[model samples]
Target: MATARHARPKELENASLEEIMDRYVARYADRRADWAAFEDAKIEGYKRAQHRFIGAGGSGKHNDVSAIPAGNFTLSIMYVPPGQGNAAHTHEVEEVFFVLQGHLDVFVQDEDGRKISKRLGPWECISCPAGVIHGYDNNSLEPVYFQVMLGRGKPETMGYADDDLYKRRDEHLKAVS
Candidate 1:
């Protein structure tokens, strides 16, 4: 049995078969990745990919009818190759990472530059509050997979914590263009 916190809309309950099917189904094959946005072999050492199933994520791409648009939050899966991870960045909205496979080390940096990190195994989860500078790394030899849930339907752009890395990313883009 399933329950909803709020009553279901009469219109939705009475929707046509095709409309109902379209509203509820999302297939894995339809997923697309913005590999160039984050993973550039020359700019960064790690190769991380984000698969948007629910929303376009903070990058602002792939927000089409094909994707299940998020109303209050966004959900996506991340594929991180061994020895690959994300650069330190901050988000205006809360961000959560739930480990589904392999090992991951999540690091958090405070305003004063003090940093701390923790390791997450399968089925583990960690939440970084709004405006917290955090990043993830896969230290294991095996690839790591995790689900990312953001607090907002359309999150603001991520703020890179390291100024040098941010500048480097901009320069790299300019050079490639």
Candidate 2:
């Protein structure tokens, strides 16, 4: 059921390696944001948060894209300072991350609900299956930047496990200690 589109616009077209690189360079030329914006959607939710994702580029600043719908897929650029990273969360869809710069220490839940941590370097990629509880922690001295792509449906739900993170604070302390 995975059919690729044939005639996408040159800008949005999924192209070969060289062509994609060309498009990226051209797109980056006139763009002025410290980081890149990939996609966004407007919706009426319980908390009313704008659904926007950015492409990997800067240290802390990001240019989020919200003008277009992700259409079953979401892409975002995640940047974490030396010691800062995202909290544990899970989505209804699978996600794939490509490391663009620096290194990232990713933490995810195992079958027995244990945390599995892995350090990935540039050009490496990681995948989080749907319904998996996972998050990333930046333990490197330098900032870590990566691009995240997730599958999305028309009605998508994003769930965070912040409470679970706190609940596992004892495990966290043990890891850091």
Candidate 3:
């Protein structure tokens, strides 16, 4: 949900209605496909492609000029293959996962390492609050497509719960660049 504290990009602050519509629109055909978007995406269980829409979500591709300049939030469409998902991660702002296709197993973990998961089918969604350890998996026999939204336009990248992965969090940027 958008808030009253939104910050409009400079280009949109005083643009004509036509220009605003043109620049603000994000089309599925124009999404940027980035596999290996996060540190865990380099691991077997976390292999998925991040299709950038608004900003780069939490993928750390902050300079992705092709994306619409975000205002207080970011959005991306994730393409998760069967048997793949992401490592548990926490962020400074809330993150929403809305399933668009296929079944996804979304989970949030306790400090003691226990995790609770629920299966989300098409049109289902979950909003993981800030600082919560959470992630999702495509445990079904097919691939899955879901939309992810972060509560900040240029927020810090995710904090992985796994020490090794956390240490190499910025490596994804190096690999992609």
Per-residue lDDT over 124-172 for candidate 3, one digit per residue giving the tens place of the 0 to 100 score: 9999999999999999999999999999999798999999988988987
Cα deviation at 14, candidate 2, in Å, is 21
**Tens-digit lDDT track for model 1 on 94-173?**
99999999999999998788989999999999999998899888888999889988888877656777786655544323
Give the true-structure RMSD of model 1.
4.3
* Per-residue accuracy of model 2 over 1-177 as CA lDDT, tens digit each: 877667666656556768555434423334343221111111111111112343321111122332133345655556556765655567666777688889888778854668989999999988988778886766779877677776652323334565643343233123222
TM-score of each: 0.80, 0.56, 0.90
Task: Assess the local accuracy of residue 37 in candidate 3 as a C-alpha lDDT between 0 and 100.
Answer: 78
Error of 2 at 76 (Å): 1.7
Using lDDT as the measure, the top candidate is: 3
* Candidate number with greatest TM-score: 3
TM-score ranking, high to low: 3, 1, 2
lDDT of each model, Cα atoms only? 0.75, 0.52, 0.90
Model 1's alpha-carbon lDDT is 0.75
